[model samples]
Target chain A: MSSKPESDHDVVVAGGGAGGIGAALGAAKAGARVLLVEKYGFLGGAATSSNVLAYCGFYKQGPEPVKVVGGVADLVLDEIKGLGLGCEPFRSPTTDNWIILLEPETVKLALDRVLDAHGVQVLLHTRVAAVSRTADRLQAVTLAGMEGRWRVAAEAFVDATGDANLALIAGLPCRTGDDAGYLQAATGPIRVGGRDRSVPIDRARIVAAFKEYNWTGAHPTARQDGGIFAEVPVAGDMWWMMYDHELVDLTSKSFTQAEMAARSAAGDYVKVLRERVPGFENAFLLQTGPQIGIRESRHPPARYELTGEDLLSGRRRPDGIARAAWPMEDHSVPGRPVYRSIGGEGFADIPLDCLRALGLENLYYAGRTIGADAAAYASIRVMGTAFATGEAAGTAAAGPDDRIEGTAT
Target chain B: MWRKSGRFQSLAHATAGEMPAKRSCPGISRDIALLLLFATDDLAAESVAGTCNSEAVSHHGLERDFCSSVILSLPIPIMCGAISAIQGHVLGLRR
Candidate 1:
């Protein structure tokens, strides 16, 4: 044990999302003591926090659903299926890509159970306030929670905080958004209730409504065509991604402004839906979200930065630990997203080096924190891919000689 | 009737094409529901071209899943059409 620190754990994961959960469980399963810290009151990251309720990259985008991510990720799926909800990959008719629909509350309980079963110690409502490190190694992280702040040392650290919070605190080289510093627009996905379920939803009607609303509505939406809508599993309500807010800056105040703008837009959108769309005549906003879904933010550099060419070519590597199957879904412009499909075998291998921080020896990254160029980042940043990368990061963090088991297939 | 599933507390609500077999009309089966769920975008568009009649129901295995029986059924055509329309957006999708 490191005698210089207040407390010690084998691995300290700084996020409670898919990546962090995967890291915590992976390290614990590999016979290492693990501590999982979450900024939110509960786990499930974007699913519970920002209402981003789908797990992409689990399956390839093809005629038939081919499982791409497994290993530790299967444990979460098993728990979800044990909860009696079908864990089948639901294909998005528009993109023809496979994604596992998530019900946040169910996901929270399932994650809690899975982490507990693996004996991972969890601290909720906690944030990684600061990091203590040497020239090449991280020593400890100061955690702020309701109980008060405390310092905990760990032999290995995994930065799965999506926004690269750990790496930024460690003074590692990081980039914001793309090389151009333009971030993808943020989205506020709301659940609409009080809908007339008896009547069928007409796309043309909604599109016509959006056209009229955009012309003169108080809160005009940038998404000219109506945004993505899906059936939220448990609630039986419409999960609508109608509002897109462009982030002006990385400051908390800027994020607050975008969030409020989206919330205001959500109100006006529901009103338009009620007045114009048929089935949504009585539609009420069930959930606007606790916060907007951030598509891109701070990205820390890694040992090897994956590029768009690798994704386009579906490049494979001997040291690859995870698969990047989702397309390059770039949303650099607000209300606009561009998707470029994976070439070759329809998936690219993310080498272990992509998860290892460039300068920090013991610091690893998972989820959106993994090193990737803008194009590659768009493909590998989804929750499902995050699980695969996180497991590899956790496994690697647990022991220097350990390799991920049964994941690349 | 909507029944609550245990553990997750999810309402056993049927999605576009995955209606309960028991709730389906005389000819529709679970396998048929699965087929309808994975049907091509063209098929969905063509299905919407016609009205919700027995001819359309029998040909596409809609029987009760897409048109009649289930209390909480979301028709496949409506769902797929909406998705296709979004994909048609100038900024969102490109082949």
Candidate 2:
């Protein structure tokens, strides 16, 4: 709905996460001037900021790992492979879902190189603070950085901030967590070093360690069962995600508390591992977090909300822009996650309307900001699916000149 | 350094999910309070400024130059505080 006014860039993407990366690269590759804004100093969102050192939703759950996400996402995988890190899909022993293990440093460097190659203008350490909009169209966003605040008008905008920060600031109606206001518990994944790699990880020993820790240790873990544990690629360190905490609220106070508690528990858990587990006699906490991994936050409504029924049925649409293959991995309860598989072909088509914001012509949704019910959101919010939606939104936001062909509603 | 305000006293050691509000931006004051609490360890703008100067020189020359000119214009300590204050101001934490 923009009146072809003079603007800073053709497409402006807020947030530097997986979704933002996809959006920026997609728009730029589609022959549009793209600007990507991230709050962190680096590019990888949760992978770099938080300790989520794994790329999920890349494959489906089966005896064989079937590739689901492609397009611009392949660029990252190719770059990662070029960096000498394994880009192969590894089956998770815990969830049985295939994932690509990651090292934060490599991911950060790879993302930087790929975005640069694509000619996407990346603004690190910058956040989109305020938004200017009309009744049905968005005009510009004020970016707050270390230097100062500046307003940059754009023809189209993509909200990939994971929290729907752009939509919220633009006064768009958004849903928080679920309809009942219950959010999925956030996790704090840790990397433990000095572990003896000769001996394989024993699940029984981990369960026993938590049992004793709960009885005697200062910071007891709620996850009694051995949580997601695997060896990180390249570094050979242990990547464990046993620590889980429910976010009391969305405030930074609760976030800080959870972060501190996770750190404290991380140290305590490492000590127990060294004392009990045979392979972890010298185990030490290598990385707790620069920040905690948040699962869900805000959801802005789109033209059509992708429903749980659609996901369960694994429906394919004529206007499908992306395919979401990840299961409905719900973490509604702390330390207890339930994953429901997609029916039919084990992948559901995400319609293009799911990325189009309702009542707004120029604004689009990407990543976790896409409109979906709670269950569908759980399925589509992973980083792999994020790339698909982000690319679709960015391509659409380029004003149909280079819009993707053959996807007709 | 930022001091712990009384608003966080109740939730300081809370482990349960008994929070009051659900999903609103906790306003700017609370954001400033939280930022201040962790800003020291969060590292200042200098780290990023240094990366922009070195690593990004080959890939993103223009952004690197802009970052360097803007950041290196002032001393690191002053720039750090100023950037924090500027961010707080933009977030409505300061008038």
| Each candidate's DockQ | 0.01, 0.01
Error of 1 at A122 (Å): 0.6
User: Please, what is the whole-model Cα lDDT of each candidate in the order they appear?
Assistant: 0.75, 0.76
Per-residue lDDT of A239 in model 1: 83
Model 2 per-residue lDDT tens digits across residues B1-95: 11212112111111011222212113323322232221222235645454344432332234555545544554454334323423322222111
Error of 1 at A49 (Å): 0.9
| RMSD values, in order shown | 18.3, 19.5
Relative to the unseen true structure, what is the C-alpha lDDT of residue A300 in candidate 2, on a scale of 0 to 100? Answer: 91
lDDT of 1 by residue, A1-409 (tens): 2233377998999999989988887777656889999988899888888888889888888889888787688899899889876779999755678999888889999999999999899999888999888999999999888877789999899999999999999998789988889888888988889898888777788888888888887667766557777788877888888788888779999998988988888888888889988988778988977778988899998988999999999986645667888999988888777889988788887877888898888999989999899999999889988888888788668755312111101
- Candidate 1 Cα errors over 4 Å, as ranges: A1-5, A402-409, B1-95
* Top model number, lDDT: 2
